[model samples]
Target: MSKPLVSVVVISYNHEAFIKQTLDSLLSQKTDFEYEVVVGEDKSTDDTLAICKSYGDKINLIFSEENVGMIPNFIRTLKAAKGKYIAVCEGDDYWIDPLKLQKQVDFLEANPNYTICWTDYSIVNDKGELTKTDFGYTKDIIDIDFNNLFTPYSTYTLTSMFRMEAFDLELYQTLKHYKDNSLYVLLLREGKGAFLNFVSSVYRVHEGGVYSLTSNYHKNYSSYLNIKEIMEAVPESRSKNMKRILNSLGNATAFGLLKQKQKGEVLTEDQLKFMTDYFKNGNLKTKLKYFKRRFLK
Candidate 1:
């Protein structure tokens, strides 16, 4: 077959119940340009590999004999991509709009300044029941640069499509913690991002979901680590924005610890120090809040 214009990477591990739907959603995409679906089945303990194999020659299947974990599988699968544009659809999530890829590719083709494009998405429960719609944003459209990319307003990985050239695979392989947020930062550093108003995918929240199923503490701590990694990965020229992103993440981490303290959990000295460190360079309001939380009964 001729080379595809776009490559879709679907990473699966023990997603036996959901792999079929994920592959189906991807395969069902109606695009004028050619696109390839690359499935990386990370030696799932369940029937995910079998389900992926059932697709046969329809997708470029990469199945491992042993589990390689999420990040490694992601990197290797990405390395296998042979297209100018790259898109991702996790095993649990599925795209709703058949024209999702076409719309995103068209936008990227027209907008040379933007390196990445993502649409709004819906949230669905395990049973595939729609829990919420018009998720991510209410804006008609928005531009995402490095500064705002660290904010709450951001791209959903499964709904995103980005230029292959924008991705730094070497740098990505070096990251200690690999998450979608970090990947977005790496890509945005090359160019800006765009948020299309339409909902094109469904983000599944299930018991097995890595992020959704974690405790608040783990989630908050993970967020802290994610930002820290991004800060370190950014070059010195972008240090100004990195500082801002650090302050934002630090404040959020402190508040997360405070919530845990209020829940009858004692804050460790290390936790308190980490929280206070974030405020040392912060303003008076932030320092006072930290003091009140730290010293006040």
Candidate 2:
């Protein structure tokens, strides 16, 4: 009769080979508080749906009749979720630490100013083999804002846990077709974001991944569009933050254009100015890197 303290939303689509491990790892979490696992199987062409069903009553499963794509599936899973805090781990990825949920929940409960918390994570191959490389924050706990958070791939999705009440549902619906970063931006806009120093999850990189399937240019462009949407979503009252948002967008667009230039695409004068300004206004280390690339041997 009581609601769970946290809702773990797992979105699956043709992740038959990985769903079992993902679910197992998720349900393995040892928590003092009650947490529900909401699995949204988006009509996977493979045996993903069957595997999810095998969990039976252990998880709240929503099996789609047809493939509704990732964004729709994410939204559907979010809708089914009922918890004070929402944690996400795609079917292709799995949680590494059992305390991930409890730790994040505890932190959010203690810190009213922090809206979201994420941990470090490892990268795994399609075969579930761990790669030597890991993704984590350099600092033990980094407080991030909209301007610093808009860059692409700054954090892993599986490691994220956010407060349910911090977001605007109508604004979130506008991002039904956008990537995870769009939601990340909205969460950051609500309050500060924190990163735990410890590794708590594993992100699987394979041909089936949403961004992995596309070219670098496509991913960059998609990130660009997502940033623009966030800019539009920003309230007019927050003019200062809006300016920083524009700066972040400009920096991303400039870098994306540079990538295009490498492939023989010509850059316009306006685009060049954007890049120059990014380096000029960047921090000391960033300015040094730019100078080294521009003038040094």
Candidate 3:
């Protein structure tokens, strides 16, 4: 086939049960332009490799001899993409709308100022039953930039399509943990982002899911680390927003540990040190609030 206009990166591991559905959704996209599915099979011990191979030349499959974890696999798959635009749909997630890629590409083509575009999505169970509809937002968020990218709004990876030129491969490689949030911040640094009104994908919440299955502490700590990395990755001019995000993450981590301590969980030395440093570097308001939460209440 000729060179694709868009490249969809699908990272798969032991997702034997859901890989087929994920591939089918991507293969079913009815786009006017050519797009390739670049599958990064991380040496799955299950039937995921066989399942992906069954698609033949329909997808550009890259299987590793040994597992190299998620972030590395993602980076390598991105490196393999030859399209002008790039999209991500992990093996456990599936797109619901057949015109998902078309809509995103149309927006990016028309709006050169925007670096990335993402739509809303639904939450599905392991059985593929819908648990929630329109899971992201009720309205459109059209003016997302680096200054306001770290808000509570959701930008699911499966529903996003971004300009390949906006990606900073060197910066991404430097990050120890490259989460979706990290990618959003990296791309937004180049330009702005857009949140479409319609839901176009289904995010599966199953036992095997990475972030979904992690504990509250692990989730909070992981977010903190991701934000910290983002702060270091961006330019110093963007430090104000990154610092604010880091402070919020620190608050969440500290308060979460405090809650766990109240429930008989012992705080680790590292956790204690984090709380101490968080308060030490915090502003007056943060100190006052922590004082009230710690001493008065």
Candidate 4:
């Protein structure tokens, strides 16, 4: 086959019911440029492999002999991508618009200053029923600076398409957890991000999702450490601002670990110190909350 302009990396594991729909959605994309679908099937014990095989040479399929975890699978899939742009849609999610690829590619081609382009998406349940619409924060096409990417504004993974060469592979290897956020931050460092302000994909929330299986403390702690690591890896010029954001996020996560301790979870000594320092420097309301959580119990 000829070289592809964009490569769609589809990471799959045991999605017997949803794989067909996901593949079909990708195959249906109406784009003027060439694109390839690279499917990473991570040794599913179910019929997912068989179903993917039915597609034959329609997709570039990579079958894992053993079940590698999601991060490994994603890294492998990303390495196999042979395109100028990389668009990701997990196995459980699917696109809603046929012109999704065309629109994103057009925007990226016109705006060389942007590193990533993403659109609004709708949230769907396991049954594929729409739960929430308009998931992105932007109201019009706009550039999101690096600082904005660090904020709590929600971005949809299913709707994001980014330049393949925007990431630093060496720095990416050091990020041990929080793939989505880490990737976003790394890409934003290359250039500004673009928000298209239109719904193009659907995100499925189910019991098997990462958020459903992981505890809040684990997630928060991982984010706290990952953010600190990323901040340190950034250029020295940006260190001061990144450190400020780190303190805010770190203290909040430390406070979360404290809250989880009442349920018999153990926290590290450094975590305790972080919480204490945060309360000491915080306003009266934050100090009150800290005291209430610690002594009132």
Candidate 5:
């Protein structure tokens, strides 16, 4: 009931069945740090809002009369964040490690140069069963150059914690709909990003996720579209880093599209020419990624 040092933000909609477990995991953390769980219930038709309120004083529950999608919901709840650091736990997922907060906070506080730190995750299925998808980012290494920053295929969300300031006005605009990638890329370009060696939580990849229903949800995948926008949003001094970051995002999207389907078929010959020129001028890893993407997605 005392003031919390860390704000554990939980965003939920129609997650009545799984939300309690997620909240319970946050409440049951075995750390010395004082933390409070804040639940932003975005107009659920199900009993999700009621379940969040049932925790009473244990959680700060916000019930919205109007439903905003993930991006707006995040912007809304973040306004209520009262912690030096903000950690996210979606309604469907749970933190497996009780010491997750303590470790992340200690690391971030000790290393002020780093803007964010994210641990690996264990992917779980709808029935709370662990899946074989191996979806979490498993790089047991720390951040190197901007190359590692641009890997468009990271499962880093749901296990990451940030210094809140990463969502500056410039970052907020750059994020657009690709909030996660926007945050990751900005921090990588301007500050440091540490990949924790520990696995911290379960990322429940349910088939009927609320995020699945929205067409705009996958806008992050089109990180290609976010390039020039991010470049312009950032400071001129950081423009070089933005260029590399943008290239990485564009190449990653091309690779993603190829792996997923022939979305390239929608491109005009001119568009294809532009893409091929990008591939030709890119680094070896980027070229190889483009080739694999053209063949696969």
Candidate 6:
């Protein structure tokens, strides 16, 4: 068959409970451009593939015999993408606004220099209900400058879109599991990106889901290291003051590790230095102010 208009890659592994909602959400998009749904069912023991097959001509699916995990499966599914631009919506996540795809497409078409775009997302309970959590990541939308990307923000893959060339093979090989942040960094490093501001998707938080179990404080440190490493690889990135931003992140993580006794997680000299140098270089007044609020009675 001829190339499809848009490639919407959806990764699923044992998301049988929520896959239907995700599919329905994609089928309801209000874009003027044509699009195809590419499903990578990564060895789900559940009925995820069976459900996908039920859609037949309406959707395209790829079922694997072995689980390739999140990053590998995501990269694998993109091989089938026939659209000039690729959009992503994970298995458990669903888009709330039907105009989500249309908005992103319009922005990319109008701005050729920008290769990436994303909107804000809201958190939802397991029963498909919105939570008290925030829907906007004002930190990112306000300014997507390189420094902004380094700082922690509300950005998530469910609300983001990237052009096909967002990552090169060399970069992808270097960054394996941290695909989400890697893609964000690559786009920010190369071209301008837009923050749609509108809350276009619902990021579901099941009691048994990912964010609920993963330690946020721990992940932040590792992510900071990855960003530092990538910056070092890109010579032009030095102009963005990437090193200072990473140093600040290390300082923040040092305090975080101190609170949880995670300094033990510092396995090597590099990890130890990341914590110590930041601590030694930390501003005295700032440190004192922090201790006053945190320790003083």
Measured with C-alpha atoms, the lDDT of residue 175 in candidate 6 is 64
Q: How do all models score by TM-score?
A: 0.89, 0.79, 0.92, 0.86, 0.74, 0.80
Residue-level lDDT tens digits of model 5 in 1-297 = 566678888888889989988999989887787887888889989898888888998888877788997777776777787877888888988888889999999888888888888877777776667853343445564662354554434435677788876657445753554546566656655578787878788877676575534343144334556555555554532445556666656666555444444633465564456566767888888888677756664
lDDT by residue (215-264, candidate 6, tens digit) is 76667676677666767666556645566666556666776755544334
Which candidate would rank higher by TM-score, 5 or 6? 6
Q: State residue 218's C-alpha deviation in candidate 5, in Å.
A: 5.1
Candidate 3: worst 10 consecutive residues by lDDT?
A: 132-141
TM-score of 6: 0.80
The candidate maximizing lDDT is 3
Q: Rate the local accuracy (lDDT) of all candidates.
A: 0.83, 0.78, 0.86, 0.81, 0.71, 0.74
Ranking by TM-score: 3, 1, 4, 6, 2, 5
> What is candidate 4's lDDT per residue for 1-297, written digit by digit as tens?
799999999999988888999999999999888999999999998999999999999999988689988888888898999999999999989998999999999999999989998887878886757965634464678676655654545567788899989977777876766557677778888888988887788888888776645876666667767776776676532544455666666667768867767778776887777666767887776678778888998
- Candidate 2 on 110-132: residue-level lDDT in tens? 99999998887878876668864
Each model's total of backbone clashes: 0, 0, 0, 0, 2, 0
- On the 0 to 100 scale, the lDDT of residue 143 in model 4 is 70
Q: Could you give the candidate ranking by lDDT, starting with the highest? A: 3, 1, 4, 2, 6, 5
Scanning candidate 5 in windows of ten residues, the lowest lDDT window is 212-221
TM-score of model number 4: 0.86
Candidate 4 pairs with clashing backbones: none
After superposition on all C-alphas, the RMSD of every candidate to the true structure, in Å, is 2.7, 5.6, 2.2, 3.2, 5.5, 4.3
lDDT pick, better of 1 and 2? 1
Q: How many times do residue backbones clash in model 4?
A: 0
Which segments of candidate 4 are over 4 A away from where they belong? 133-138, 150-152, 236-245, 263-292
**Cα deviation of 227 in candidate 2 (Å)?**
0.2
Candidate 1 Cα misplacement greater than 4 A, ranges: 133-140, 236-245, 258-284
